[model samples]
Target: MDMNAYLSMFIDESNDHLQSLNENLLRLESEPEELSIVQTIFRSAHTLKGMSATMGYEDLAALTHEMENVLDLVRNSKLKMDSFIFDTLFKGLDALETMVQDIVGGGTGKADVTAIVTSLQLILKSDYSAGKAAQPPLEAAVTTVDGSTSASGGMLLDEFQSSILLQSIEAGLHVYHVHVTIRNNCLLKAVRAYMVFEVLERNGEVIKSVPSVQDIEQEKFDFTFSVFTISGLTQEELQGQLLNISEIEAIVVTALDSETLAVLSNAPAAAAAEAVEATVESSAVKPKAEIAREAAPRKGQAAPAPANVSRTIRVDIERLDMLMNLFSELLIDRVRLEQLSSEIKRSDLTETVEHMTRVSSDLQSIVLKLRMVPVDSVFNRFPRMIRDLAKSLDKKIELVITGADTELDRTVIDEIGDPLVHLLRNSVDHGIETVEERIAAGKPETGTIYLRAYHSGNHVFIEVEEDGRGIHHERVLKTAIKNGVVTEEQAKQLSPDEINMLIFAAGFSTADKISDISGRGVGLDVVKSKITSLGGNVTIDSAFGRGTKFSVQLPLTLSIISAMLIKLGSEKYAIPLSSIVETGILRKEQIINVHGNRMIEFRNGIIPLISLSKVLDSPDFNENDEDETEIVVVRKGEKWAAVMVDEFIGQSEIVLKSLGKYLTNIETISGATILGDGYVALIVDPNSLIK
Candidate 1:
C-alpha cells in the first residue's frame, strides 16, 4: 500500500506509455482516417491516466484526461483530426513528459498546465460541424489559440494585417502566427528576440508584432512574444529556423489562411453565446482522471487482473553488473584449475576440469547475453525525433532503420545513444535538403535517411546515411580555412575524405545559422571523443551530389574477450583475437623497409611490421637476431599490420581489466588481462597501431 514501493514501476510504465503515445500520435497525424491508430493512442493515454491517478499524481492525471476527452470524440467520429488538434495533443504530450521527468528527478509530478487544459477544453466544446461541409482550404478546419478570451490576438489579426495575410494565402504562400517564449533564465532577452526576428526576416516578413518590434528590441516585453508572419516556407521550416536560436525555450506556430484568420478574428463573438452552456456541461461531465481515482482500490486491497497477462519482472542493472563481476572471478579460477589439471596429468582431475569448462562456457554465453541489449532500445525514440525535425525543417525525411535487433554491451548502448542522436540530427538539418531544393535538383521530393546497424568481425557498425545533398569538399575546405581549423596550404593538400573529416574538428560547423538541433559547433566533436573513449572509431564517406554516410565501429563487449596471449620478450601481452587475421612466422628476408618503417608481406599484400619488444620497451629479449620471428597479422577496418612477438602462448578467453586512470599515457595498450599462469598481460590496441 506504500506508494514509495511502486514509484520505480510507476515511472517506468509512465515512460513506456508516453513513448507509445508519441509514436502513435505521429502515426495518427499521418493517417488521420485510420481510427485504429487513434485507438492505440487512446489506450496508452488511458492507462497512463489511470496509473497517474492511482499514484496520486492528480496534475498528470488531469491533463491526460482532458487529452482523452478530445481523443474520445475523434475516435467516435464526433470530431476529425486537424493541425490544431495535432499540435495541441503534441503539446499535451510534451507537458506530460516534463512532469514525468520532474517526478523521475524526485519532484512532485506537477506543472502549470492551465493553458494546455484550456486549449483542450476549447477543442471539446467548439462546434466544428458548421464548417465541416464548407471548410476553407486551411490546414486546420477548426482552429483556436491559448489565451484568456478567444478575442485576444494570440493570433487575432487587425483589418490591415489580416488583409495582407489573406493576400499572401491567396498567392499560395503560408501564413503563421508564431508564439515564441524565451527561456526564463536567459540573460539577454533583447538579444534573443533580435536573433528570432533575424531568423524570421530572413525566411519571411513579419506582418505584425504584438509588443511591437521596437519594444521587443528594447526588452520591454516579458519572456513571451507573439508575431503574425507570412512566408513561402512551410510552418515547419519557419518554426525550425526560429528554434535554432539559443535561449529560446519553446514556440507554437499555428498555420492560418484566410478562413482560419477570419475564424480567429470572429471566433470570440461566435463562441460567446455558448460559453455559459459549455462551462456548465464541462463541469457536469467528470473527467477520466477523477473517475480513475474514485475507482482505484482502497489501501491493502488487491486489484483484479485479467488472465494470461505476460509474466515478467524488472531487475536493476547494478545487480546484473554484480553478477557479471562474480562470474569473472569464477572464470579466472576455472582457467587456473585447467592449467593445474593439464600439468599434473591426472585423469580424474582432467575429466572434472573438462566438464567444468563446458558448463562454464555455456554460463558465460548466458551471462553475456543477459547484458546484451538490443540497439532498438536506442533506435525506437528516433522516429518521433525525425518526425519533429523534418517538420521544423520543412523537409521530407523518411528514416529507414535496419538491424534494430542488433545487440551491444549495456555500457556501450548507454553511451552510444547521444552520439547517434547528434549524427541523426545532423543528417536531417544539414545532410537533407528542402523539398524545393530536391525538386530543383531533379531528386525525389522525400529524402531518405538510412540508419542501419550490423555486425562486422567482432564489432558492431552503426551507419547513418542520407540520400540528399552530400558533402561538398570545396565548401568544407573553404570553411575549414576560414575557421582556422587548417591553413590554406594544408587545406589544398588534403584529399576529399580528409576534408570531410574536418567537419568533426572541435568547434567546427558549416551551418549559416545555429539552431536547437546541431549547429553550435559541438556535435560531431563530442561524438568522436565519446566513441573513442569507448575504444571505437568513426569514419565518413561522401559523394558530392549523392549523399553522405557516417560509419561508427564499436566493440561487441567491453568485458571478457577471446585474446591471443603472446610473450613480448619476458613480458606477457594479449592481442584481442577480434583484431588478428592469422598468425605465422616472418623471416628477416620477408621483412621490407618502407620509408624507414618496417613492413612485411601477407596474403599478396604489404603491411607495416611493429616490434612488440621495442614498442613496449621490454628488456628481457629482442628478436633482431632471431632466424625467424613469430608474427600475428592484425587489422583495423581495412588497414592491416603485422606484429612481431617472441612467442605465441595460444588463444584464451580472458577478462579485461582497466589499467586505472593514472595509466592513461599508454595509448597503444587498451587494458590489462589476467593470464592462466596468474601473470598480468597488457592488451595491445590494434586500431591505434594500424595508423
Candidate 2:
C-alpha cells in the first residue's frame, strides 16, 4: 500500500494520540486505582503501535508495545502504578514522542530504547502487589495473550536452524536470529526474500530458514521470514547493510548464545507456536487505517460526542491568510471611497459608501473571528507539564486554571507560549514553597498556582498567581543593589510594586542556588521581553509573605485596529484607541518641566509629557514654539503619558501592516497603517513610549 498519501494524516492523528496518552497517563498517575484511565491509555498505545507497525516504523511500534504491556497489566489489576512504574512509563512516553518527532523530521523513527525496554520488562516480571523486586531471568520471554511464553532466543528453532547454529559455532563465527519483514509495495516478495539472504550471504553465511528456504524463495509464507545464521560482521554493520535493501521494512537481529540454542531446539513446536500467532493476526486484522480509526475511545473512555453529526472540510491556513490580506486591501479602498464621498457631498455616493461600509464591517468581523483561536489550545498542555515538574521537584502544587476559553489572535497565541512557560516555571521554582516551608508558614501543605485568562475590551489578560511565599522586597532590593541595577540609596525610594518589577530586570536573580527548574536569573527577563515584543506588557505584584502574581496584558489582535489619527508637523500618526484615555488641549504654560522632563498635572496626578516631533526627531520642530498643543493621553498598565500633537484626524478603522522587516527595531512605532489618501502613518506603541 502507498503510505505517502496517508503520511500527513498519520502525523496529525499520531500527535493527537500522543497528547491523549500524555493526558491519560497524567490522570492515571493522579488516580492510580482508576482502571478506566489505564484502559484509555492502553487503547491509545495499542492503536499507536498498530499504526506505527503499518507505517513501517518498527522502533516506534516496539516502544509503544512495551508501554502497552505495562498498561495492560495495570488495567487488568495484575500490577500497581507505583511512583517507579509511573516514572518508567513516562520515560517510555518521552522516548516514543521523540521517535515520532524524528519521523516528522524525515528520519526513520529509530532510537536506542534498550534502557527503557529493560525497565518495562522488569515491571512485567516484578510482583508489584506484595512489593517484591524483579530479578534477572536466565531465559526470558514476553507472556502472550494465551498465558504462554513465546520462544524469543531460538526456543522455537527448527532442526535445520539448530544444525546451522552448531555449524556456525564450530566455524568460530557468532550465531544470530534475524527476523526480516518485506516492504508492502516491493518489486517482488520472493525476489526480495532472496535479497535478504543475498545481503546475509555477502556479510557472512545464512545457515537455515524458519519456514524453510524453499518456501521463502517461492513466497509461500507470509510477508515476514526468519533465519538463523552465522555472521563475522558486527551486529551494527550487518543491521545497517540489511536496512540498505529497498524492499525491507523491518529487521530484528538478535545475537544468540549456546545456552539459548540448546534450550530452544528441545521445544521447537512451542517456540514456533509463538511466531505463528503474529502472522495469522496480522493477516486477519482489518486494514491499518481502519484499525486505527476504530481502536480508540474504548468503553469507559471520556470522548465527547457532538450534538449533531457535522461535516468539516479542511482548508489550508494559508488560504485563510490570503483571504484576510485581500479583505484588508478592500478595506483600504473602502476607506478611501468613504473619504471621497464625504468630501464630494453627494447623497448617492455617500449612501452607497455607507452600505458598503456596513457590509465590509460584517466581513471584517468574520475574518477576525476566523483568525481567533481559544487560548485553551495553549493552556491544555500546561497541566501535564505542571504535574511532571511538581513530581520532579517533590513539591505539592496545584495548577488552577480559569477562563481558558478566552480567544486571542492566532499570531498572538503562537508567541505567547514560551513567555507563559517562563513565567509558570518561575512560579513553580520560586513563587511556590515546599511542603515543609508551607507548614512552617501556617499555610496549606499544597501550594496553589492559578493560571487565568480573560478579555477586557481590546486586550487579553493572563495571570499566573501562586499562594506561597511571595517576593521578598528586601531581598530583591539587596540583590538589585549588589547587581548594580539599583544603588543602595536608589532602592530606598522604591515601592513594593517597584521592587517587584525589579525581578524582570535583565540578568536578575535572587536565588541562592541553581536547579534545572530555575535559579539562573534567566526566566523573568525573557518573559517580560517576549510579552513586550508582542505589543503587550507584563507586571508583577507580590504581597511579601502571601504570594506573587505575574499579569500579562496582550492586544486581542496584532493586526487591524480602530485608532485616533493625529498630525505631527507634516506627518500623520496613529494611536490605538484601546490605549487612549482622553484627548485634550494642553496649554504650553500648563506643561511644567520637572527635573528636565516636561510634566503635566491632570485631574489629581502628574504625568510625563512626551512631544511627538521631539521623539520622532522631526526637522524644525521646537517644543517651546507651540502656545497650546493637542495632547493625547495614553496609558501603560497603571502609568499614563500625555503625548502632544499638532491636530487630531478623527477616528478610523485601519489595518495594521508590518513595517518592512528592516524597521522592526523602531522603538515608538509598533507598525504602519495606510491612510485613505494613500499616505502611510506610523502607529504609536504607547507601551513602548511610556517611561
Candidate 3:
C-alpha cells in the first residue's frame, strides 16, 4: 500500500505524543511511584512504535519498541523508576522525536540509538530475574491451552456432526472445538496430538482451530486443522476464510457431544461474561495503553469508532492570505454600503443594510479567529531547552511559564519562536549566575526565569524575565560608545532605559568572556529586528542588583489591523493604531526648531517631529500658512515623536497587503491596504520612519 498519505498524520501525532512523554517524564522523575505517568509513557511509546512500523521506518520502530519494553516494566512495577531512569528515558524520547522530524523532512528516519538502546537494555538486565519469574506463569497458562490430550477427541467429530456444527454456526452462536495435528515433521504424532488436547478449553467459545488461535499465528499446526465458530456466515464461508490463510492445506469442522455440549454452553456463558468484564477492566486500567495498542498496527484491530471526530486540514499559507485579501475587499464594500445607506436614509433599506453589516462583522471575526493560535504552541519546547541549558551551565534554575494559552495570530506565532529561544538562552547563559554565586549573593540556591504572556487591548505581550544579575547601564553605555553605536554625548544624555536599549545595538554584548551561548557577537539587535519585522516591539527593563526583563508586544493579527488613517500630501497612509499615542491639530507657529530639528510642545513635553511627506520621499509642498497641520504623535519605548500630515482621515480597521517579493528595499512602508474608494494606500512602518 502507498503509505505517503498516512505519513503526515503519523508525524504530527508522533510529535504530540513525544512532547507529552517529555513533559510527563520530567514529572515522573519527581513522583516516580505515579503509575499513571508510567502508563502514559508506555502508551506514547507503544503508539510511536506502531506508527513507525506502519510507516515502514524500521529503525524508528525498533527504537520505540525497546523504549516501550522499558516503560512497560516501569508501569508493571517490576523496575524501579528514578531520576537516572527518567533522564535516560527523556533522552531516548528526544532521539525518537529527532528521527520523526527527519522523516517529516523527507529523510530516511534512521539514527544511531545504540547508546540509548544499551542504556534501556541495561535497565532491563538489572531486573531480569524478577521479570522472568513473573512472566513464566502467564506463559505456562498459554502453553497448556495449546498442549492437551482431549483436543484430539474434540477434533475427530465426523461429517454429520460437522454439518450440525455448521448449522449452529449459521445461527450466530459460538462453537468450541479443539484441533490437534502433529507437526508435519514430528516423530511422535499421537503424543503431539494429545499435548494439544491437554490445553483444549471446555468453554463454549469456538476454539476456532483445534490447535488454537495462538498456534495458528505461530504456524505450529500441520496439514489438518480443527475449528468451532459461532459465526452467522455459512460453513462454506467459514471454510473459505480458513482456506485463504497461508500454509494451511486441510480443514475439518466438528459438533459437540452431549457432555461436551453441556460443558460448552455453561463454560461459554461464564467465560463470555468474564471476557466482557475483563475487557472493561483492562480498558479502565490502561485506557492510554489500549488506545496506543489499538492505534498500533495489526491486520484487523477494528477501525476507530467515529464519535465527535474533529479533523485538521492542512491549508496553504497562500490560500489564507488570499482569503484575507478577499475579506478586506468585502470589508471595504461594507464600509461603502454603510456610507451609502446613511446618504440615502431609506428606513427599510437602512435596516437591511444594518443586518448585512452585523452578519459581515461576524464573518470577519470568524476569519480572524481561524488565524489565532495559542502561544503555547511556540512555548512548549522551551522547558526542555531550559532543562538542558541549566544542566550544562551547572546552574540550578526553575523555569516558570504563565499565560501560555494566550492567543496570537498565526503569522506572529511562527516568527516568535526563534527570538524567544534566543532570549531564553541569553537568560540562562548570561542573566542567571551559577548555583554557588547565587547562594553567595543572598539569593535562593535556584535561579528563577519567568516566561509570561497576556493580551491587552488589541496587542499581545510576551515577557521573559530572569531573577539574576540585572544589566549594568554604565556597561551598556560604554559598550555602545566603544562600538560606535552611540556618540559619547548621546550616551551622556540617555536615560537608564535608553542606556539599557543600547544592548540591542549591533555587536553589543556585556559578557566579559565570549562563550557558545551568547557573547561571541550577535546581540539583542537581531532579536529587535525579528520582532519589528512582525510589527512588534521589544523593550528591556532592568534593576542593577535585581534582574532583567525583556518584553515583546505584538499586534493581535498582521493581515488586517486597526489603523489611524491620515493623508500626507495627495496620498493617504495608515499608522497602526497600536503605535499611536494620540492625534491632534497643531498650528505651524506652535512647531519649534530646537538644534535644527523640528520639535512640538505637547502635553507639557517637547516631542521630536518628522514630516510624513519627507519620510515617505514624496514631493515637497509649500506649507499652508493658514491651515493647521494634523500632528499624529507616536511613541516607541518612552520617547515620543510626531509626524505632520495633510489631514486626519479618521480611524478604521484595514487589511494589510504585502508589496510582493519583488519590491525590495521599500523603507517606511510596511504594506499597502485597499480603501473604501478602492484605492491602495501604504501602511507606514513607524519603527523604520523614526529610525
Candidate 2 on 421-496: residue-level lDDT in tens?
8888888888888999999999999999999998653578899999877888888888999999999888999887
lDDT of 2: 0.78
Q: For model 1, which pairs clash? A: 244-515, 244-516
Clash counts per candidate, in order, are: 2, 1, 15
Instruction: Tell me the lDDT of candidate 3.
Output: 0.69
The sequence of per-residue lDDT tens digits that candidate 1 reaches over residues 465-556 is 99978888888888889989999989879988898889999988877888888872458999999998887789899997899999998877
Measured by TM-score, the strongest candidate is 1
* Overall lDDT per candidate, in order of appearance: 0.79, 0.78, 0.69
Pick out the ten consecutive residues of candidate 3 with the lowest summed lDDT. Answer: 137-146
Q: Cα lDDT for residue 491, model 3? A: 84
What's model 1's overall lDDT?
Answer: 0.79
Higher-ranked by lDDT: 2 or 3:
2
Cα lDDT for residue 608, candidate 3: 89
Listed in order, each prediction's TM-score against the native is 0.66, 0.63, 0.65
Question: What shift in Å separates residue 140 of candidate 1 from its native position after superposition?
Answer: 35
